[model samples]
Target: MASTTDTKNYKFNHSMIRVKDPKASIKFYEHLGMSLLKKLPFPDAKFDLYFLGYDAPQSVSHGKEIWDREGLVELTHNYGSEADPNYKVNNGNRDPDRGFGHTCISVDNLQAACQRIEDAGYKFQKKLSDGRMKQIAFVLDPDEYWVEVIGQKSVEETEGVTTTDPATYRMNHTMIRVKDAEKSLKFYQEVMGMSLYRTNENEKAGFNLYFLGYPGEKGVPQGYQADREGILELTWNYGTEKDEKFSYYDGNSKDSEGRQGFGHICISVDNIEAACKRFEESGVTWKKKLTDGRMKNIAFVLDPDGYWIEVVQNERFSGKPNF
Candidate 1:
């Protein structure tokens, strides 16, 4: 099995989005009461970045609080200019046939967010409607990128907002696009030692669910058995042909912006230093050394499909050290 590097506890962190103008995007989200959590200057890329959340609005009073109490939406302004206000933010190049879609962020009140964004005059490719199990709706970000709002939080957030316990919001799952189901199954299962969780293997829809994680010798519950942390969801479309190798900034890849399908996933651990060392030793040092501290000791690594996987060591995973 490929070494996962000694990870602390695994929890769901945040999702990253590429943008032409972070300021404009932040303004749009701020109108809806999202607070800017952190900002980073990527001098190499000649860009400024920001992370926004739904817990608080931007204000002098609320701005004094350093600790954000909710999930976040990261916005990256590329080091360039843009003539068009409506920029293309979908990652359709990775899987052209699948149509670049929007990233879905879990919310407490799906209907309320939809109403608020709708009132703010944001366009929507789809309206707020019923889901198979929950409520969902779509809205365009300031850059014309589609987004989905769901009424669910990360599995680790057992309690509602305002809770700082790291154990509450563990990284739930990640979705990826693969060319072949059988091939991915072998790579993630045989190579990664992930079990085949609930999957839609039927070729009709051409989607299968393969879960990758470290589980206890004896199975317990759905998300409880994984001692190593959370799970990685490998999504493969059995019918369509997708780019085997895609670039996040290539701009020609089908899913370049991760708007259509589920975007990149971030997993938070207790020991990021050890994880980087292990990933380095495993011949997979794609983004070694984490290079950035804006996300609080975070590092980025990509999987087989070039999808970004972030590893971090937040305070939440400091519980009983399994290592």
Candidate 2:
């Protein structure tokens, strides 16, 4: 258990995904109004990290400081993933067993955004009119990664009509598939101090969707999951727990084939030392502890199902605010 001083709040920073072609991936997100906030290259590590965000005025100067922006996408490009013709980034579409799911972007006008995406010569996995869920659609990126498109309004309001608004667009949430819903839920709730904001269990569909968020004292009000930002969606297939060997492919894992697709989810904490101490006391699995890496301020903790969760000091990325 964390001491009173060690109990600090956490904010979702970014979700990373491995990209085959940086140019194409960046273009795809740019088409959706995400600007490249910063690009950090680790020559020794043989990889580069590109951070992209939704909203930024010209007056706002962004670099590493843009970490303060919620819902940012970090595209990780290995040294030769693009140059090697045989290398492939698992987008989860081809392999249903992959752990990473789709990342969502909320737009003021779902129809207009879909049209824009279509006009840009992109194809949709599920169009607005194609499914019973009219308000939501799925667009595929260059790597065949699913990007869920959601409208700002409720499903009832988006009935059969195209809404258009250019100004409203932002990163929403990243969904991940979990083998054991109960175990994963316990890790997130007990270890990370997150709250279960919403849950949707579809018996007919044979699955359950759980949305978790770090809502502080001001808890989430009823029926606000759709609008709530920076939430993580855990998709649990009803009977995966029955099979002892059943497990989803974590993008960060490697087995001579190369690194998997999706990278990790990052959370910013108030104090890195305290957080690390707490995690140690809780017996959470550590991928990269603060003392293990050159970047001493950042650490990576693995959830129950082996998904990497990055924990970092808030000030290290965003910097301390000026009083």
Best candidate (score: TM-score): 2
Per-residue lDDT over 208-279 for candidate 2, one digit per residue giving the tens place of the 0 to 100 score: 999987774456637755454567999999999888988888786673355478889998776667778888
In Å, residue 50's CA in model 1 sits off its true spot by: 0.5
TM-score of 2: 0.88
> Candidate 2: worst 10 consecutive residues by lDDT?
55-64
Deviation from native of the Cα of residue 184 in model 2, angstroms: 1.0
Can you give the lDDT of residue 101 in candidate 2? 86
- What local distance difference test score does each model get? 0.50, 0.78
TM per prediction: 0.60, 0.88
Residue 111 in model 1: shift from native, Å?
3.8
What is the lDDT, from 0 to 100, of the residue 230 in candidate 2?
68
lDDT, candidate 1, 175-229, per-residue tens: 4456566766664554333466555455665566555554433332364322222
Which candidate's lDDT is highest?
Answer: 2
Clashing pairs in 2: none
Measured with C-alpha atoms, the lDDT of residue 26 in candidate 1 is 86
